[model samples]
Target: MTDTFKHHLELLIACVIYGTVGIYMQQLEDMSIGSIIFYRIFFGLTALLFYLSITRNLGQLALKRKKKYLLLLGILYVLQMFSYYSAIR
Candidate 1:
């Protein structure tokens, strides 16, 4: 089906982008590893927020229902990233 083909194409492109992150990171050795990780998170968060806003999905997120869990999850993500960045460096 055409839908399956598009799904595969999307996965392929995601793979390419993920693969390219290594090359991009390799080019940024002069920057502090924290800076690199911060920039990555900042840009990714900004883009994700923008996409959600443009699609008017933020209003549908029901954050009030999961505020505590979401907050904990976010903290966990940051902590995990700190360790991951250290390992990557």
Candidate 2:
């Protein structure tokens, strides 16, 4: 496939996944929102690490500079996810 075609396909798949998140969240209403968020992040992180390892890019995560900025970004991401899930609940 052409690069543009491949990119569009990926975006479409992502949109479908995004649209289904609320449905899945509703099905998991018995679980605490925090637990649901934790599982989502954990599974996402696991998939990312698996992909990076498979592509031999795991070492790219090691940064000698801007470590503080990375930490800040991570904190912001968790907060954003927490708020998003809370709102969904």
Task: Name the candidate that leads on lDDT.
Answer: 2
The parts of candidate 2 lying over 4 Å away from their true place are: none
- Residues 1-89 of candidate 2 have per-residue lDDT tens digits of 99999999999999998878888988998998778878988999999999999999999888989989999998998898788878877
Query: In terms of TM-score, how similar is model 1 to the real structure?
Result: 0.68
Model 2 lDDT, residue 82, Cα: 83
What's model 2's TM-score?
0.81
Worst 10 residues of 2 by lDDT: 80-89
List, residue by residue over 35-83, the lDDT tens digit for candidate 1.
8768888999899889999998987656668788889998898887667
